[model samples]
Target: RSASNERAGRRSRPAERAGRAPAPRLAAATPPPAFARLGQAAATFSAGAAPTSRATRRSAREDGRRDASTAGSPLTRTVVRVLEVVPTRLRIALAALVGLGLLLGAATVVQTVRRRRLERQRRRLIADVGVLQSALLPEIPEHIGGARVTAAYRPAEGLAAGGDFYDAFELPGGRTAVLVGDISGHGRDVVPLTALARYNLRAYLEAGLTPRATLHVAANVLAPHIGDRQVTIAAAIFDPGMGRLTYACAGHGPPLLLGTDATPVTACSSPPIGAGAPTGRRQTTIALAPGATACFHTDGLDEVPVASGRLGREGVAEELRAVGPEGDSAELLARIVRRSEHQPDDMAACIITALPGGADRWCLRLEELEVDAETLNSGWAERFLLACGVGRPHLGTALLEAREIVARDGTAVIEVRVGEALAEVRVAAPPAVMLPIERRPAGSSAAAEAG
Candidate 1:
């Protein structure tokens, strides 16, 4: 009975060792209850939180699969694997950088659209103002009365229009009236005042009033309408029949008289028109010789910039002298404007030159001649051409051209001038006429004949 009891105890001991080994295997196979709850909470937090990027969600799913596969492994091993896979700080920094880039791209697109819209509106405004300026200031005629008239105008650089104006027109009894003026301020606002002063002064002069009286009347008429603006004007009446020029100044620069022993007509001036009642203005009369030039200009001519300072009145005079006595008025003004270093204001200039011979001498006596006579009598025309120093061949050509013109046009005035180097012929039909004339230089004619 003792031997049988010993065998039973040994069998029980082996069974106990086997059960202990299986117990450890069971524990490794399944996670603890606390670890399972922690894993479930982590899944809930991932699902309930704000939506993450596709890459982040994919990585989270992969981490979950790996943790499930390693469930039979140690808990410390699972924790170390999660820490290696997740990089919260680096991912947050990358996301912030991407968001900033998107914000900047949207801002650039908005700014570009706004800038283009503003540019289009500004260009359209400039075009409209240019058209208005042209209508306000018309072109001056080439001839007024018996004198040759020429003018040039240049607005300030980068401006469409400015406050300088000039006008000339024929008056009664073969007299010419002229005006050159400057308004106080620039741009579109001053244009109306400029028109008012110019047209009103013209009306007064055409009424046969003297220059001083004309200025006085113009000031009174414009005073009420000019508002706070002022106008500087130089007005003149030239009578070729009387060989005289009468002028008045109203706070304006003096008109320059060239090609004679004459001085600037700048005395007896008053304040600019529209500044107070017109008073104490006087007209100065000067003898204008044949071939003399009368030049009138706005302040822009003298206000040009130079190395020393403003070109000034003396600089303008020097430029005029450099143009020489023979330079045409239009050409001279062009040269002066081209030489200016900077143009800060509007420039306007006009010139009237008395013909070398009297107005009648330049016109053929066509009114007294018989146009329909059988032979077209040219004896008188020949004598007039000879008096003008025309040679025999040029004289014959002038007579034949004149006779042909009269026969075709009924009545025509012909102008003939003979010089050492050139001969010119001008034919016109009249009331007010600008003749197209041709000049033949002696050298060129001789060369043609030889060829």
Candidate 2:
């Protein structure tokens, strides 16, 4: 009877139980969007999968624990959360920047490699060019035609090459030819001309032409093509047979005679070739005694700096004298460099030392000049005759004859040979090639005056 009544009371309290509040919930609020989606994916994974054996399930659970541990790391979790929230476009742009940086690094490496290769090639080419340029100024032999020869070539500071050039070679008839000259400018425009002038002068000298004649023809040949550039050349022909060195200047420094006290002949100084002046009109010949040395050089020696002023010819002579005949051209240049502060131009020199007892020393010197007959006057002739060391009586006689000869011919060549005892002056007709096209001014003799 009690069991039946309990059942009837439980049924009657159903409505009250139903009206009471449900048990308190474990979680009240919804998860965030990222977690919510993750939970959904987990539910789907659980429902779609087939049942697995115990061993597989155990391995899966172990992997899941490991994955959870890794995901729980603070830095990793933060990075993952940031990535999940980041916009797709921003991620793509970041990827593009990384790829571009990689490409740029590769390009930079390639460019650097190319630049190094080019630098190596440039250095090699420069070295090769230096060798070729050296060929332009050759090494002279120790002796030519029984005369000791020495030479030196020094470009200006910080230069590989310049206009200065020189050569000494054996000529026909047991003679030797020496040439030294300087161009006005540098670079491609002048290199070929320098070579051309040097070789051409040598050929002319070898072809049995006098030093004055060789320069005369070269002046006319090179003048028309030189444009504004000019060349100053000093040439010499040594006849070991005659023991004489006949030298001439084309607006160049006079040759320095070593171990001699006599003054250098400076009469009838010729102007430079290409200067439109009467070039190669004057030449001087001197006797080179046994054991004598003669130096042929460019104007660089005269242009050095000193305490008083520019180191002129006298200064250069002093230096050469100090060096003495025993020294060579290279040694001479070295001494000059040590003494002077600088060299502004290219320096080149050719020195010839005569063998002792080579030939009889005449103590004879000669000077010759080609003058315009129409322009020849008494005053100019007097100065020239006096400069030639002609005495009063001979001067009067030579002047009278020069006037008569000039009246007869268009031009006269005055040949003066000075000896230890006497001076011989002879006036005669000049060669057709030497006749001047125009009359010289009255004071043209000023440049010809001797110091």
Candidate 3:
């Protein structure tokens, strides 16, 4: 009986403690504002996260309505009451509108990022192209082989760069070689070929090959690679010590000899390389008078647009004469740009001028041809020998020797070195090569072409 009574007392005491624990604290407590509850109820109907249960959401709205009625302003209470009666479709439409606005903002940000990335890529491409152009058309020094040398290049209006290129470098001996060439077309396709041609010709010239040999080798090498295109090329070997300029062309403009002489002989020509015809077959040798300037260029300079028509070879000569011995390639190009209304093609030019004060001007000159032994035996060969300073018994003996060598070897090389009053002719054995190497010999090197 005592145990039963203790259990009853323990249960009654807990009930008594619960009833007295919190009933006295109501007056001292700080209650939450009713308007704050109203705001929470508003958020539930907005684009915010949905309530976990519909029953819970309804109960909260009911509690907020009562709280608003008890303590909120008339406006707050009216809004809460309207939220409770709002249709489900209207709420969903409002949420959808908000989501659409967010999507549009995201799209705008993505587009801005993409545009910036593309702009950076464009700038990089431009920089790379600039570097490539510099490699293909490099800058050269002011002098080569003791003569003032300058070069210029200009692309057409629509091209960043083009097919034309030029180079000038000192050779193995005290000679200087200048090269200029034009590929038939333009754009990216031509740049690789331009580099190939420029460097290939330069390599041969640097290796002590004559201008004619250089072109011959270059023509064969490039023919296989250059599809449906031709390379018009010119190369010159200038010996300042010897005061002589020897040059050859392959379907390209001849080097202009200005100031002292009118121009280079251009009547003879080998077709452009890669044209299914032989090149480097012939070369012209000229004596350079002091104060003389040699201009080597691609055809574009002569083809520049002018008031009357294209700038012809005459115009080029006139410009060089105006620029005179003192002017470099840069100055000459500047004048051309000013005179030209537009450039129709890529132009490249190299200018080489001999020193003003030098030794006595050379009077001996030979622009030759390959004549038959009969022609050499003719009276013409005798006069030629006499003019070369060969006399009497030796002249007869030299003529007989030339005939015998021409008949025996099918051809031999004749080297002529004539000074003020002295002329010397040498008949030398030809070098071993695939083609007849004309070092100013066989005027059949086309018959080594006799002059």
lDDT of 3 by residue, 87-116 (tens): 879878977998999999999999999999
Q: Give the clashing residue pairs of candidate 1, or none.
A: none
Tens digits of per-residue lDDT, candidate 2, 10-106, equal: 9868866788865787988877999999999999999778677899887986686557546777887676556556687998898899999999999
In model 2, where is the ten-residue run with the lowest total lDDT?
430-439
On the 0 to 100 scale, the lDDT of residue 195 in model 2 is: 91
User: Any runs in candidate 2 off by more than 4 Å, and if so which?
Assistant: 1-130, 306-308, 378-380, 431-451
True-vs-predicted CA distance for residue 386, candidate 3, Å: 19
Query: Candidate 1, residues 53-127: lDDT per residue as tens digits?
Result: 999988998788677657766776675576556597976786789899999999988998888886787566655
- The C-alpha local distance difference test score for the whole of candidate 1 amounts to 0.68
How many clashes (backbone N, Cα, C below 3 Å) per candidate? Answer: 0, 0, 19
Candidate 3 lDDT: 0.74
Q: lDDT of all predictions, in order shown?
A: 0.68, 0.79, 0.74
